[model samples]
Target: MSTKPQVSVAIQWATEADHPPFSELSNAQIRRWVRACFADSADITIRMVGETEGRQLNNDFRGKDYATNVLTFPMEMPSLGADSGLPTFMADIVLCTAVVDKEAKEQGKKPLDHFAHLVVHGCLHAQGYVHELESQASLMENKEIEILKRFRISNPYVLEGTK
Candidate 1:
């Protein structure tokens, strides 16, 4: 018998918006994404912020001036215990709600669906996935597609006008 790794997610809403309810960022939803792409048990915090803070974080960490939909900050820490076979993963995922809302509208996608994709994408990054190269991007994208499929979400890379 196999067991899934345990995931603890703490969601922080740093910005105010008349968007969906906070329940949308449920633990089950987050655990599903984390488990799909990672083998280790994790402690993750997801923060929803406005464009200003998001842009500042992006600028400081990634050197990008504009705010991105999501940013993953993986933590470097020691293991919990030696006897525990599972590794402990810790990360902070920041979501720019305004950017997510804007991008969803522009892309003709549901906000919930787009949010789910970004969450999954950010979790994968916490597990060391990257898209800095063409091959790496393809691999990461394929993993995202498979995980999103389980959530009944279509491939996010497929835009509205594209075949």
Candidate 2:
């Protein structure tokens, strides 16, 4: 029996305005970006919500006033050895599409490419990647770049030239 971790993704979008290119981007595409940075057996939720819900979640959890592009809520639960031999749950990745679009334009990146970057970033956070320190930030950024490359997307930081 294979012991590879199962990758499961549940995606939700808010209304018509925040609709993502679900058909243009397949679950495999998003999953590949995530799996490249995380263990293959991870379970993730990628929710695309509007400003209101995004703002509420951000404020409630992070005490931020406005909606951010992506928010990660990790399960952080210990595992119970099961027949599947994989953790039952991982974390949730919430994305504000409106913010993503705006940031993409501001950062001068294609919407699809920016969306992929955020998905990769959010999934990494779900898998316990942090950017609180310079070292950690560098590591996370490197991982995001590697994953995005697999999808033919350029380095997000390079395009935005933040570094």
| Best TM-score among the predictions, by candidate number | 1
- lDDT per residue for candidate 2 within 91-154, as digits (tens), equals 8888888888888888899988998999989988887789999999999999999888887999
lDDT of 2 at 82: 67
Q: State TM-scores per candidate.
A: 0.86, 0.85
What shift in Å separates residue 34 of candidate 2 from its native position after superposition?
A: 3.0
Question: What is the lDDT, from 0 to 100, of the residue 91 in candidate 2?
Answer: 85
lDDT, candidate 2, residue 132? 100
Give the CA lDDT, 0 to 100, for residue 103 in model 2.
Answer: 89
> Per-prediction RMSD in angstroms?
2.6, 2.8
